[model samples]
Target: MNKYFNIAIVTALSVAITSFKGNAMSDLSQYVDPFIGVDGGGNVFPGPCVPFGMVKVGPDCGGKDWNAGWDRDGNIHGFSNVHVSGTGGGCKYGNVLFAPITGNLDMQDYSSPRNNEHVALGLYEVDLKRYGTSARLTALQRSAMHEYTFPASDDSKIIIDLGSFLSSHERQYLVGSEVRIISDKEIEGYTRVRGGWNIGEPYTVYFYAVFDTPSDDCGTWKSHRVEPGKREQYDTSEPTGAYFSYRTSDKQKVTVKVGISYLSTGKARMNLSEMNSWNFDEVRAACVSRWNEILNKIEVKGSDEQKKIFYTALYHSYLQPVDKTGENSKWISDEPYYDDYYCIWDTFRATHPLFTLLTPSKQVDMLRSLLDIYRYEGYAPDARSGDDNGRVQGGSNVDILFTDAYVKGLKGIDYELALEAMIKNAEVSPGDDERKEGRGGISDYNEKGFVSTKFERAGTRTMEYANCDYAIATLARGLKEKEIAQKYMERSRNWQNLWNPDVESLGFKGFVWPRYSDGSWWSENDYSVFQGGTWPDFVYETFSWELSFYVPHDVNALIEKCGGKEQFTRRLDTYFSHEKWDQRWYMGLFQISNEPGFLTPTLYNYVGRPDKTAEVVRKTLKERYNTTKEGIPGNDDSGSMSSWYVFHALGFYPNTGQDLYLISSPTFEEAVIHLENGRDLSIKAKKASDKNIYVQSVKLNGEPLDACSFKHTDIANGGTLEFVMGSKPSKWGTVGVENQL
Candidate 1:
């Protein structure tokens, strides 16, 4: 093992051991079901991966649902070493594929119908019925170990397909590939591919593979021709791979270890040192142990079903924004490097904040990574993968993520550089590739104070830009950049510039209307409240009614603009009523499935209707989420949906880019958050049950909490947050309503 990897492993093991010693080590990984969202639009990858590890070794179905590559029903095409979990849209990764075969090597008919499939925290197993082979997969940080039990066959073979990747429904195209057989038992190669969700630049994935048993015959193949004597293969667009044929007895097990890196095949070979021995069980055990360490950070008292849902959500939340600390081949950075932000627009709402609270150290590393990317890449990403940034959604949501870490006082980040990045995002236009990074329509947004109708998703852009400005303003004020703070704070209210009071929706007087550069509103004929199309729509992925509720930093103003508390409260109620739900667009006014509506259920807290917030939150939790293959209501969005569940289940929700957490009902009787600062924040709900979902009273640190909100400072050092729950709504937080914002 390399010294650096050894040190990292030792440090990680020491931390896990210490945490195990500090707390009672329950087998928490048992509650995590990796398959919960594999079939649903959740698009979750059901595979073996350590928390935030680079290698997600899983099965690919080769279907259009290739986002995570595997669906519950499709045939197992192959097992690939990298995948994104719980993300939607175009797919990326799924590189370095390996498939076991028998008899004639017909690539076209090589896929097998899987049977006896199983998945857990760090293990995935399936029986490939066609080949009568049982494949078991496990992983460490950067490598994967596959154990395949093959039936008696002289032509038992393993194909390492360099050209194979998760494609379909996206624009993934292979740029080039090179494979060299090192020996009968080893091979080294790399694949250069471009275009996925991000429309990313061609990124090379280098890999090294080794087998425990040597093959009798090994050669290379391109497209349809298999060259028996050729030891190497290089190709641009044609399918290219290497095959090793072996004689095997019935139930003979063959183990293959593969390591991947973005830097080089040498680094990929070094990553194999993560698993020093060929003990697949040891790696699986270590992976389980690491998962236990993460899942144990927050212990909860609930039913097995609830625990399954909660812990699985927690598991999914840690699966992405992968920890590629020393693997950045793009630029030299000692600051921790991470990628597959997969887009911060989805995660900034809850996932990043959850990190700020539970895993502050990792959160700090991620923040540093963001700043470092800004340092080298000119812009911090809204969505990024393959060491490049692109496919920005809304404004630069990284501004919100950074401000969130700032307000919560996460350390080890250069706040000055962070502010500079935020300023650049606000002031600079991305020009041609604005869809990929930074803000689109920045000229009109800055000059006219609103994203004009000329821009697609203009209304949504205007609102998100306002939120990003608010985030910038918040961080600037804290850093004593008073003039910059004042400028952005005033600019933060520019969402109001898009508010056309004459435009009514669902009997509500005001909605954010798309405005032209000349400051004229788009005619009612030109737009619809349910402008539900994506990319080219007036709003992105949601209706104007939904985006209208998205003014998070200034909800008081939003409530006032919607005709005060009473009318606003009724509007929110009507949103959740489901009367206007349209299957054609998934157009429920309050879309629990999507991120835009994530905070709407809790908006009643702003109106001093904590009871209403509790009711809506609990209802959404009960109805929209469960522990099943199709459990998640929508795409998990790189754990964004799961983190939403994690927060609401624990009885609080974060207002991203702010220090505040809005109070709600708890599903568990007790939830203990083990903070990185060596303190435990315990949330206890008296009579917390399905029936008793309303908060009757609350106390923080034994003192009465009059409002339905609390700052991060209140729990940063850890304390008990006690809630008295009852079936009936009480005026517990109604009196101190002004404290919400």
Candidate 2:
């Protein structure tokens, strides 16, 4: 670890430890460093939120377009009420902003040199140095509590902006808005915007704001002050809002609660009713308790730095697919409502499986939400924000998410309806409706067994659809729906059609290459410039060679395609040999920063080379991840990367949607996962250290397990998995036996 990381870890440990000084003991949330990904490509918003809560309350530094809200190098624009956690494109949510000022209005945006900044799970606080003010934030499921302390001044004012929703690629505007001064101490209003992450998705956010101490003066402003004590209705698309100037004596702390709802202002008020009093400490404590309940699901014995990374990773994992069930009981049925799936393409790989181990009940509700959305909206939602579905990536990938939950034996969902949704998506062509509900080029995929370059990113789309097909088939077979299983199972092999046995560019036989509608190759000279900069869109942010290894459901078949095991091993060696990363290519052959490349490290286990898997996984974690602001190599993608780290650090990975978890040498001495089934799965990496990054041998419940993989039941049923670690790789888990798919 570097000096900054050491300082960060020690400081985090000190806070977590010192929090227990006056109190009897401490909780895991204390060690969470929300700032780890703020500066890094992690692109994570450090803010106040409960686990899967609908509200993400945080500061929006207003970095031109990047979303995560807070930027280490940017100025503090104002604190916004909502944010999409760890996403790439432009920022989303962040409507209903509140900023504090003293004395003059100071129309100039404050350059907040952040000080005394501390953030844990469910809580965030920062001192605005320029304004000499402090802001602290905590959240409820649908509401947020903000406490601001201003210097002794009578001019302390709180400004509420109803116009600026988070900046996006397509700038969002307040098409219509209404502000009502409900009373001397309360106000209720709402704003409507049409453009967010899903460019044309309409979103209307309602908020009910209340103050502990009534303001002496209140007025409405649009670019400038307009009226006082009057309910204002603004129909034009312009910057509009209200401000409450307080009459404070000295260091008067004011507490404010804002409840948000997608339903109506009444629902927002009801959401705010949960905070019965103006007790900031009480609300803060309650937020801490809620976070602890979730973070305590896992316990690990490791260095303070390791613990910080693990706990923070877990914290980031639970920040999305927020529960919007409380939005309005009337608009949505009694079924669960989850908003901001953001993108299922980024999440299904690890986030869903991690939920299976930790919170299976939430997974069931989330599945129910997907089904409900499908029943009402004619299709399951993929990358959604608020209530609208945006352009999807990777071919109706929600099939993979729903199927992953169902196959895990989770209850309380309409499985038949879910399967219906999956099949409907699989069969329906994309152009059948203007909304683009199902798979694009599905007709072509079904007829030709492969998608042609006629559609953009044909290679990426084909592989993603095949994976979804495999997941659906697996669920269908388990449910004894053999006809559905057989149909989709045949479709799952469509990836084989995209394989070109003679790819001169890759200097190998049988690599996945794009072809035109007539089965002619669409060749590009430099495959390294696959996407990103200085490259035409050859692939969707991935090299054809990297995606060629994307047959997750049937890696054995992929091995066969590469001319058996020996040649496959040589290819794997060549893939990892390139240590240099070009700007055109985000990362090298094993793009640890991206999702398609996540499962590549685990491919070694299939070739009876679990040692190589162990080596690669350990090195990736050590070099690519850390406990700093610039920690992650790329966007966290709503905790997909974080969950990837959490599982790998525990010495296992859910390499696919299936139940099998590939094992490796854990970075921790011991890690314990407390499953929802009231069982404790303990992973003991004995003699584990930084130098000891290889698995010498393994045992499950005192029985020698020779295979490199274990069933999900092994963890869910819960028992001890012990691994003897060594400085170098051992023969353990290197057996040639492979699990039949």
Candidate 3:
């Protein structure tokens, strides 16, 4: 009998297993806890949304820290129709709010304490303590359905706040807004706002809402004053909203459907066709079914806690870089258009690679969307939201994203056009608008072979740009452009320009140090191992020790620079074992909370120490992650962090912009990844447990594997990777270490 079946039997004896709607007990959505990352800095939206849906309808609490518009302990402000999931930094998209109340309208005091909250895939319900009402939220692709059950009152009303939005630490100003009541049952409005993560860039959101029944009275409000029976209100810089008052009996239920669009109110109204009826449960069931379709791509047999974390991570991974296929207002194209990348600097490591395995078609569409953005917008954005791009953290990491897809043979993208865009990022600087797109300080990088101290984040940008150049070189070689390929291949070594063999830290020599434009290094007195501060610093969100291990394309060179295999392995050990030194979020020198350190734990494979890699990865997976409100160690970074967990839990981690997966210990007994080519890539670990965590042996399709790595082609067409586990580390993948190098 299968180990999973045996475990299931044992679990069933101890607990009751409820079947989902008389279907198979294995409904994947049941394992997804939407509230897992709501606390900590995870900033995950715990509400109702389908896979990559534009309408992330959820309750918005007032605070600078609610980047995704929902906080665990915060009171309910209102349910907004637009939100980003698992993102940090500046807040965006809490627009077109609908708040239900049973008494006099108080714009400032309408927020209610919420309790009995329940969040699942495609459903969110919470009882508002102030109004004694229950709000249930569900969503379609571009619209939302809200059902509010209220207490008996003659003044029951639903307030449509056109000016309300999730404010961030950055300055957020409402440019203008308008609300027009078409009937007692209907209203249409729009809000134009600027300044969030997009950094002063303006975007407009138009909404059309309809109630299930006509109201007894209707009006509009500007700031604090309410004009009863008013049909229209237009204002700038002040709060504006519309209200529909109704006389309600005890436990009267009211339903509202809201559709939103970036183009115009007409399009918003047309988008409402996605949910034609007022059957909230029916729409919610459909959303749940859609979620199941995606989550079913990967099936795992593990403990219920393991299954919950895995499925929830999978669910969060598909939630963004949203599918705005027909919603683009900038340019019309038959190709798909996606926005809210929130930034590729974060997602390129793991999230996009996971998409390539599970949904290649959608991945292709997103790649094509990046190309489309480059076609009209001059360059593809590194960080995009609200139909605009503002921040560029690190290199034009989109180069890596495009190359990762190209190397994996994901079709439908114009690779030649993509190369052109990549070259633009390599060769040209975006000048004053460099923060929005393309490489900043490219003139210096192309001329000096390294970004220098004159530029902010010089050391980190140089390393990331080198990696981006490697991506360009790889793509160019695939396209048969020998000259371009060779040129970029040489430029990809620019990271070495910053390598100073004299700089020492934590008993390890030769760190990548900051340098000046004139080929001089920052003095030792001014530099520390953890020198860099956030944003406008020599490195972004990380220090020199962590950024030193970010060279994924040329690990051998990195190993050689660290004084060969033994020294590199010792350095990694020190990195993992060092005492906590500062207030930064890290374990030793490994900052599991950030993206820069994601690949560090797996770097041990290069030194033929797969055992150490397994040790660190399994330890991190156990200690740093959980299925709680504060589950994630850091901001999920639009599912980048969650995808990192998902990949590692399945016994592999992708080297982005390359076709490699480094082997790690499997958390589950078995995991089956359903490929896009109508095949299943199954991974099984025998005698795998908390104690039996080291791989004693591994076989690919019944053949013994010597190396701790596998190429994408190995499982592209589907195969079985079986691992024999043991309590003690063995030299299973230690032979033929040179092959890995």
Cα misplacement distance, residue 706 of candidate 2 (Å): 0.9
Backbone clash tally (model 2): 1
* lDDT tens digits, residue span 466-527, model 2: 98899889889878999989988888888988887867444567777777788877565534
Using lDDT as the measure, what is the rank order of every candidate, best first? Answer: 1, 3, 2
lDDT: worst 10-residue window of model 1: 1-10
Instruction: Give the per-residue lDDT digits (tens) of candidate 1, residues 160-181.
Output: 8888888766778888888999
- Location of the lowest summed lDDT over 10 successive residues in candidate 3: 1-10
Model 3 vs. true fold: TM: 0.95
Steric clashes per prediction: 1, 1, 0
Best by TM-score: 1
Error of model 2, residue 705, in angstroms: 0.9
* lDDT tens digits by residue: candidate 3, 567-598: 99999999988876652456777878889999
lDDT of 2 at 365: 85
lDDT of 1 at 488: 92
Candidate number achieving the greatest lDDT relative to the actual structure:
1
Error of 3 at 702 (Å): 2.6
| Candidate number with the higher TM-score (1 or 3) | 1
Q: lDDT (0-100) at residue 59 of candidate 1?
A: 95
The C-alpha lDDT values of all candidates are 0.87, 0.77, 0.86
* Model 1: lDDT of residue 327: 95
